[model samples]
Target: MLWAGSKGGLEVRTSAGGATVLRGRFPYAVPTVLKDGRERLREVFEARAFAASVAAGGDIHLLVHHDFDRPLASRGAGSLEISDGDDALTFEATIAPEMRGVSYVADFLGTLSAGLVGGISPGFRVAEGGALVKRDSEGLLRVVRSAELIEISAVTKPAYPQAQIEARNWTPCTAAEDRTLVHALNRWRL
Candidate 1:
């Protein structure tokens, strides 16, 4: 199992209707160091490494500090959504005040908004024959071509120093409003 922290792509925000949304993009091809027993390896995830897992529609949970006992959202409960993109694995989770009879959602959101939480970390396992290894001046390097995405968590310390989390307020714009805004900008340019 590998827990890879993303590079500055996690966001926590509240919508106008009081729905809290957590969105993240875990970037691929970002090199990070991982410890394997007594050895240290430089690992990079290739593009679409978790394609099969996302395509399979497996349930992946949103947890805190990688703790299974502290799950915040899950795909099985329709609160989580995962997708694989060209350069990253994207996820969006809607968190309500109370879910599944759990009342800690607000507390968690408070901690997150207070800047106490670190960033997003993806827990995954590399598939068989999914990695290529090479040794160079940079020591051992592992290029991961395929993997199974298990869960994404908010942790206190992240392997990637650039990982970040932020809280904001969001409001959705209708399509007609979008077009009107674009048209106004275009007319201003003319």
Candidate 2:
């Protein structure tokens, strides 16, 4: 069992998973304002009033202010790279050393993958090296982190579609997948 206590900053204790203590001075806090801002963005786009515009691929108006606490605040943008696809959109964000210890984004992402694979079932293909098989709306092939793959489809779809994908399934990823994910996440750092 994991318990969160407000000791120094935010300390958590787990039975066998080891305790996590977030304290001392850092560039930011764990539950920083940036996370809240991201949540607000998701909420605004999910609002019913913006349905029509969102469906048409129009930009949702952002009423909230920028995340000033972010180290990349001056950049005013995150890293993104994409190539050919039916209609591919790739997003990448660089996390500084301070941000790395902030949250287990990969763990959160893994939970998301389990849910997506559970819902979509055989549609997902977890490659040997930890890449996930993903296809664009037009059926072009691309690989990404499982969680990002899930968000691409799940976040955009009006409703969950039960249809299965036709692609061949890849081998299951192993414990090494976690290491790969961390490397990918901190590519900029390296």
Candidate 3:
């Protein structure tokens, strides 16, 4: 839990099946200025919208820097869950191998052993993107609308203040086939 009451940071946890959970502050509410110069707080990915997307099975991935062009982890074999816990949304899913064939799993294991870098973020889209009013100790905010989650990735900096990532399932790539990786890479270069 991050920033529920005071702890302003991220919490990352690791489990079996290459499971990784990223928990922290999300700028679900953002401040925007209207044409009249009035400020409005935009809400992207509120509770309801998030729930629907998960039910719909939106495509999600674990990547570096939230980049969609490439992903480090494959899509989950099962449903992915993003729980709105405390002040953070817990993005939980299993990181799959790039694609397994021959020693592919071994190579994938090597990549995971190297570990990920930076914070966590989610890429999603809003439906109606409506607005709502809410009052808090921080201030009053005109939240725009919620969004549907696409992919939760390991990013540099997310909307809010903090984020963290946790990835489990580590195994050494000691297959005799590893020795032949250089030949494969050389072939790929060609």
Best candidate (score: TM-score):
1
lDDT of 3 by residue, 1-190 (tens): 0001112333545556554443444433333221122333222224343555555654555545444454545445453455653244555544443333425334433444454333555554333333455655444444434444556655433333332212101112234523332322221100
Q: Which lDDT values do the candidates have, in the order given? A: 0.68, 0.22, 0.40
TM-score rank, highest first? 1, 3, 2
Q: Say which candidate scores most in lDDT.
A: 1
Residue 7 lDDT, candidate 1, scale 0-100: 42
RMSD of each: 16.6, 20.8, 14.9
Q: Model 2, range 1-190, lDDT digits (tens) per residue?
A: 0001111111122224332211111111112111122222000000121122223442211100111121211113322111212222212223233433544433433333454212211112233443333433433232322211211111111111222121222334455653342322221100
Ranking by lDDT: 1, 3, 2
Candidate 1 lDDT score relative to the true structure: 0.68
Which is the better candidate, 1 or 2, if ranked by lDDT? 1
Q: For residues 1-190, write the lDDT of model 1, one tens digit per residue.
A: 5566664567877778777788988888777655433455566778999999899997889997666778888999999999998888889998875552464555567678777765788876554576778876666777878867778987665665642212100122234543231321221100
TM-scores, one per candidate: 0.76, 0.20, 0.46
Clashing pairs in 3: 43-144, 45-147, 130-144
